[model samples]
Target chain A: MEWLYVLMPIAGVKIFWPGLIILGVGVGIIGGFFGMGGAWMVTPGLNILGFPMAFAIGTDIAHMAGKSLISTMRHGKFGNVDYKLGMIMLIGTVVGFEIGAQMIMWLERLGSVEKVVRYLYVVLLALIAWMVFHDINVKKKKEAKMVAAGGDAKDAVGVEWHKTFHAIKIPPMMHFNEAGIYCSMWLPVFVSFLTGWLAGILGIGGGLIRMPSLIYIVGCPTHVAVGTDLFEVAISGVYGAGTYTYKGRTELVAAVIMLVGASMGAQVGAVATKYIKGYGIRYAFGLAVIGCIVSIVLKLVAKAQNIPILDDASTAVVLATVSSLSLYILLRFIAGCKKELAEIAAKG
Target chain B: MKTRFIKLFSWCLFACLALPEFAHAAAAKVSNIVIVADTRKFSGWEAWWTNLYNESHLYFALLTMALIPTVGVIFGTFADFLMGFIGIDLKSRGDVGH
Candidate 1:
């Protein structure tokens, strides 16, 4: 147990090595599965594990860059990434984030905007959760109807947003072969800009918002969205890591150890997505949103009441929720692997 | 087509590297965030790394940025091998649209 502890000289703290590895594993699975950096999930986990608050974000981003690369490779092999679309979105994201940051600065001069920002964060999480759940419900009902009509449930095209997306013929239209989307070039650009603005306002990695936008708005399949978003995260994570390291905050040693766990976890998570339908990923992701909302509410209440224990409790709740969710995903991955292997054996 | 992609990739890479610096420079004036640690207190490998970091922040940052993803890829390749040993093909399993 004593040997499990490692000293981070830069952060001037000693952390339980295994705890960091476990945290990385959990986040790796979620990040790989959802195609987001899962920074919100990692911050609280690090806090609970007694990691220095100063180094927490830097370390998380550092590991995230590496973790996402692994996930992206796995997803790429599955033909889940759309590099062309991701690149187009990157251009829009940069411009949008700049504008959003400027708007925040203006608001800050008017008054203290911390409370407002936190409230907005909560509302955004709630709205996203509701939307995802609603989409999944609609999908399930559509599939059931198809079954009742003596049609193949697997053939049911649940949502039809893509029809509208594809209908807009603003030139020059672009085709993303990997994502199987052919639409106006402006579509991905506009969606990315919008999501990037939200991310700038919310001070998050934007992966959460971008992943959804890629699906519902840009007309990408769910799995492609996840992989493409991971590609984006990998690039953004590197930039984030660079800045934090330049500020002398990243703990490279800890990040390295985390990468060890993330490597395996990412494979499991990405493979699991292949087993499940698009809506299944959406359902799981929606649950994660609820978990985030609860955590944010706890933090807000803790801040309002000036209760230290409540803050700690909030961290605990997040850690518990994420740990459970990651475990469930891992279990599903194991089951999916076994089933796929059996199918292959049958074919043989 | 390959050359065009390479050119596009280089520009994107440039933008990715530059935006953070622009954001940080602007953020420095308005944001209350500050680095908390003192480099003087660091010793051993920490001191060495810290000194190098301070001397050339950009270089150190780039190095770190490269190191992380490289490490991740190595780990990923290792995992692929281990999974292969167990008869699971990560590359080809359930591959769909490309």
Candidate 2:
């Protein structure tokens, strides 16, 4: 039992070292697979693991930066990343992020911003969940119609909102060859700005939000969204890790331990993407969002009722969801690898 | 229609950018709260790490930046190698967009 726990030098807290490894591996897989940093779950998961809230955030950001670097590199190799689009969005992301952070500082003077942020999380998660399901439903209908008309539905997309947005025809129309999108340049900039603002207020990497927007709004393919979002996450994570560390909020030893685990997990997750299609990724993402919502709600209830038990339960729920999802992705990765290798051998 | 949309979008963007200044944070910044690690029981590597944190946060931050990427690249390459040996080519994705 004594060997199970390790002391964090900077935070001065004894943590179950296994918990750190689990979180590292879990976030690495989830982030790599979903193309987003797993902060929504990791922050609460870290607090439950005995880190102070600030350290949890800083440490999570640090590990996510390193983990995202691997995912981005892998995705880039797959031609899933649109570097042109990513570069365009970088402008809005930086500016929007500053505004969001500044607003947070201002909001703090009025009252506790934590409660507001929690409520916002619930609303955002609900909206995202709805959007995901609605898109799936629409896609199914479109495919049915296409098949009924005696046509192939292989490339049918349920969410065509990007087409409507593309009609805006704002000047400086650009093309992203990787994403196969031709739209006004302002679209990506504006979309990234909006997502960046949400991320700033929520204290996250904005991967989840940005991924969907890239698909539904920016009109990118599913794989492109995941890869491009990972690129953005890597960029934001770098800035966040640097800022948090400078502020003396990060626990480096924990971050390193987590980064090592996450790095390996990222490889598995990224490779698994080769076997899973766009909608498959979306379904998994939606489930992760729902998991985050449940954990946040539990935490809120615990705070309201002053129930320590519920708070602990919230932590359990987050870790459970992370563990289960990571395991599933890992198994899928192994299966996909075996099948691919078998086919290659047959070819030989 | 395009003109109307452009005007509206520009206006909204302007407002969002300017809104941050409106809050006029009575305090120009958030409270500068600092932390100290309890290193009384620390020894060896732990003591060195905590001492660096306490003595100079800049160096601590710098080391973290260097360490995370170095470790990540090392681990990433090793994982790629293992997977490659297992017959999944690391350079090209096998079933991209599947």
Candidate 3:
């Protein structure tokens, strides 16, 4: 067991090396699949596995920057990334992120950063889960109507907020070709700024908020939202890694080890998106949100009650959720690939 | 209409964000702490890694920023090759119906 542990040079902690790989691959697959940074789980996952809190964040950000780049490139190949939209949103995202970071020190002095952040996470996750499920329910009803009308439900979407947004008739309405949307440029910029600010205050990568917001608020298709959000996350991740490392928090060796697994994991996650389309992805994301909420609540309870057991329970729950979700996605990807291959072979 | 909406929304957000006593935040110091790794038992690359952490955080940070993306590209290309080898089409766009 002692031999299985590896020392992180900068963090100076002996970590279970395989745990690093698991976190890397699990987060890579999950992040790639959801088109988010997967930091919600990874940050705490690292802490449980023996990283100091600051090092966990810095190291995860470092690894995430690389992992997301790989996922973004893979998504780019699939034409899922809306580069134009991503680029337009970058400025607002950066500015918003900085404001959020600066405000954190302010927040800390006001007291209870931990309690406040946990409560905020609970609220945000609850809203996201509700949104995702509501959208799915709406789409299902729409699909039923489409089926009765003898129309295809393959492209039906539950939410039509984008239509109203598109009607705003604001000046400089730019088109995002990859996402097949033409809307006021202000929409994405505003959305990114808001999400970035929230991410900063919450001490998270903004993907959790950004992904859903991209779909419901910015009017992107699920795949495009995932890809474009990954692009944003990757770029911001670079900035995050630099800031944290400069502050002397990042452990590069741990990050490198994670990247080794994350590379393959990103590829698998991105490729899986080709098989699982819109509603399918949304449904899974909703479930993941629920899992996250459960873990956070458990930890919150642990903190308020001063119970170590509940904290352990929280870590177990998140790790299990990540592992199980990855396995499910992997199996689905394999099945989809086989069916596609068989159909192609039969055509010959 | 857009301008009105933006103004209303922005103001509301600003008000909410200001709820946590704005003036009280001036004293917290999250960036003031730094840690140095003990390099006593290590040699060669490990020594260099720790010494860099102790001596120059800027260069260490920059090197990490550079190393990650470079590694990502290398791994991404390799993964592409493996996916192609398994008869997975690497060149065609995915037919994800939005």
Candidate 4:
């Protein structure tokens, strides 16, 4: 009986296991598919479940790191990982995270840290959603052109920015064989550092920011960008988790349990990428960004209006939207499995 | 086929051994500076890594068996699914498969 008391600390912390389980599953799916762990999903869910905000963030990062590792490994096998690029991005990420932390401390002095951060979060979410929607339309237009030309859509030329960027011949150039690019190493480092800074300041992984930046700014192929993004996430997340824990902000028990679900989800998500074409991934990733944006917007509106009920409603909407998106990813996985079986049978 | 399998297996082994060590060395290099800078308190890097490892180890240890096979099987399955979903079936490819 005493041993049972010792083992079961959940009794002390008023948490709903069911909520955590659901949250983990949703985050895992998104994380696996997009190379972006669902920290946005997990953190808010934990907060709602009665954990302090700091604990929620700490636990989320812990789960995210594990999940990111599993996905990165899987993506690596599929030849999607660009290690050189990821490493270069690491230099930037570390610097950015530190700078972002300093900025937060500075804002804390101004006594408007919370308000500023919240407002920024809302604005960033909206901006990202807009970007994703814009990209989706661009993709559609590209597809239409290919159809009009009677050419295979797969043969469509990619964005020309990569070539343009490569021609700059900046010193200290580096080559990423997997990404099939040679460019200034400083580019990735600078981009990652900026992303890292944002991640540190906002208290979330910069994946939501980094993924798009990698694609549009750094000009990596989408698949490679996704894989590389996970690599960066793993690195930054580990650092974040450690930093928070040392500061006594981490909830060890919650983090461990969440990791259990995240690791499993990441495996499924990572492998599913193999079956999903680049365009499909792009579309889904875009939608995930939109979902996140909507969730953040609802939260902002609730806060601005000072309506407690709206806050509750926003939380529910966030949970529901995230869960549905996650379910969609799982359904995609199952469909993929069936298709593989059919192909094997046909071969026989 | 055997050679290819061997190559992949070796690569996996290398990655497993190498990455953590790389991460550790990087952390170790900064550990002293990080520790001293924050008035002998824990640095951000230390805090982030420790919690991450703690959380990850639990899941990794628990699911090691299921984890390994899932990667290859699920990936292959997904690839087939994608092709079909995109209407790129072998019948459409005419003589390509044969």
Candidate 5:
């Protein structure tokens, strides 16, 4: 294990190469399947592997750009990416993120805003988790009612908020053909702005927030949201990686090693999305949110108590949970792929 | 619950907009984290890279930025080949009609 460590040139640190690859695979599966960057999952893993915090963020973003491109390619093949919608959302995201970053800088002038930001982060995660679970329950209830009324379960209506959004005829409406939506163009723009603002305030890549926003607010199907979000992430990740690298904060060697594992994991995760329904993905995403909440809570507790061991313990817990979840996702992806191929063979 | 969540989310956003001052008043840095590593010094390519980073910062930075995504594309293409071998299609999902 000691001999497996490699030196990071820019960050001037030694990291376990295998640990970085394993961490990449775990995050890759989650990112590919959910269409989010999964930054929260990667940070602790990097920290535990003795990667420098100064470099961790830049290195993570560098790999994320590559990993997301892989996911976007696969999801695009599956008709999961909405490029037109993504472009529109990107406009809003940039402006909103700039404003949000400025706001944070302003707040920092008065005093350190770290705790408030962390609390806000946890709150956001909780809200997202609740929303995903609620959507799942609503779908379940609707399906049950439809079956009871002698209609097919598949006939149950989907989320109604999009209809309300469409009804708001404030301005020019646009059709996102790939996402199967025709609503006020302002809808996606507004939703992306809000998510991006939150992302900026939290200083995180906005995939987790944006994915849910795409699904629930913009009325994108879950699969489309994942793909579109990955598309957005890819672009933003490149910008992030570039800026951080310019600051000499990136460890390119680590990023490259991670990308190798991430590419494979991205394929598995993206392909798995084809076999899972929208609600199924939402349910899994909700669970991942809960896992994140648990990890954050542990870190908060550790900090409040000034216990270093507790902090390490929290990191260990997150690593374990993420590892298991990624493993489960991989297994599911494999099974789903095999099943789909067999069905195709039988039909042929 | 869904309606309540929407309401809460809206309120949270509003709070973020309105209360920038009040939120940071009770701010204390709760965690003091450090990244520890051995400085064994650098030689060979590592030494040259460090010198380049210090001497021509912008060029070194540009090189890293370009190299990362290029590597990503190469790996992505490799994954595409592997997926195709496993009977997976990367061209399209045939969902155009939808």
Candidate 6:
């Protein structure tokens, strides 16, 4: 009975399992398609659901670690992973995580860590949302122009700046068979360092940055980029978790439970991505960023106003956003599968 | 141009390494509670040993957590590939119109 009492709060409302399911589904789909764990969504969702912020962060990282392992393994089998590039990035990632953890410790001393982090989350979310939305819109307009000209829409986006970066001859050049590029090894290391720096500073996986950088700058095929990014995320996530644990800020039980949910969710999400197309992924990614922005806004408002009611409202908004995204991903997966089956029938 | 690019890359790497040292210095001042509870209060060696053990455990925990991400990435990459081979090609599914 005493054990049950201890378990009760951990279980916290019966909705936790459902929440876990929804979180897993959403993250899995996004992660599969984008090669991101969607930790930004996971951490806040857990916090809103009555887990302490530190616990939420720790658990999110832990779950991410487990989920990434599953996803990376799946992706690797497809010949998509660039091990040399991932290893180069790993070096930078570790250094960035240690520094980021130190910054959080400094903030904690001021006793305004929560406020500062929330503010930063809001600002970052807004910025990321804007970038994703802008890119999606630009891509759409470009596709429309291609359609009008009766050309393949994919060619209109052109080679991004990062790909051009690969053409720059630099010393210590490296080749990535999966990426199909021979560029200075330093490029990936530099990108990883920057992404790691951001992840450490923000207390989030830098997958949001990593995925795009791999695709545009690193010139990785979109699928391979997704796989490699997950590899990067897993590496960085572990480092971040270790830093937090060293500070005695990690909640192990919570992290383990979340891991159970996320690992399973990741499998489904990774599988789902096989059916969804590139543009669909881009649009969904845009929507996810927008969802994050809204949730962050709600959290910021609740914190600023000292309104307990606002907290509930923020939680509701987050839950709703996660639910909608999860549904969209699942539906997209089903639709893709159906289309594939229909094609097979037509061929038959 | 090659030399210049190498210089820039090295510069970036050095900057990354330097930033963490500054952050760690700031972190050093923050006092963290070290839990070393025992069923009975003891003196001298037993107490010292207990403290040492607790500290080691904490370090172990940190190491375990940090390893998770790297391992995850390796695994996630493989998972992505497997899915791709299974005829999913997720990023291209929406392009059936072509």
Best by DockQ: 1
Q: Please say which candidate is ahead in DockQ: 1 or 2.
A: 1
- Candidate 4, residue A250: the lDDT equals 51
Model 5 Cα lDDT, one tens digit per residue, B1-98: 99989977975675455333221310121122333322347788777776676666468667776886777778777877877787865565532211
lDDT of 3 by residue, A215-302 (tens): 9988899999999999988877776777778778789999988888887788889999888978889999998999999999998899
lDDT per residue, candidate 4, B45-85, as tens digits? 54444434345544432332233224323543454355456
- Fraction of true contacts retained by every candidate, in order, equals 0.50, 0.52, 0.63, 0.00, 0.38, 0.20
Q: Which tens-of-lDDT digit does each residue in A1-348 have in candidate 6?
A: 232222212222223555554565566656656788677667657765566554465557666766777777666755657877787777776676666767676677767576676677667656655655666677778889889989988655533556679787778998898777889988887777777766666766678767766766677766677778888776555554665555554545455545555665565565566666545565676677676667667767877888877767766766676677777776766676677768867887
- Tens-digit lDDT string for candidate 4 (A1-348): 332221112213446665565577678777877888667777668878777663565567666766777677767866778987886676677667666766776777878677678778777767666666676677667878999989776544334545666677779988788777778887787778777777767866688888877876677777788889988777656655554444444555566556656666676676666667665777777777666767666777788888777677767776876787778878877797677668867987
Q: Please tell me which predicted candidate would have the highest lDDT against the true structure.
A: 3
- Candidates 5 and 6 compared: the better one by DockQ is 5
Structural similarity to truth (TM-score) of each candidate:
0.92, 0.89, 0.90, 0.74, 0.87, 0.71
Candidate 1, superposed: residue stretches over 4 Å from native: B1-6, B9-47, B54-56, B93-98
Model number with the top TM-score: 1
Which residue pairs show collisions in model 2? A139-A158
lDDT of 2 by residue, B7-98 (tens): 77975786556433322321133246889888798999889889999998888888888888778778877888888888996666544432
- The per-residue C-alpha lDDT of model 3 at residue A190 equals 87
- Check candidate 3 and list the clashing pairs: none
TM-score for chain A as predicted in candidate 6: 0.81
Please give the ranking of all candidate structures by DockQ, highest first, separated by commas.
1, 3, 2, 5, 6, 4
C-alpha positional error of residue B24 in candidate 3 after TM-score superposition, expressed in Å: 18
- In TM-score terms, candidate 6 sits at 0.71
Kindly report the docking quality category of candidate 4: incorrect
- Candidate 5 residues lying further than 4 Å off, grouped into runs, are A1-3, B1-43, B92-98
| Candidate 5 residue pairs that clash | none
Docking class of 6: incorrect
| Model 3, C-alpha of A318: deviation from truth (Å) | 0.9
Q: Rank the candidates by TM-score, best first.
A: 1, 3, 2, 5, 4, 6
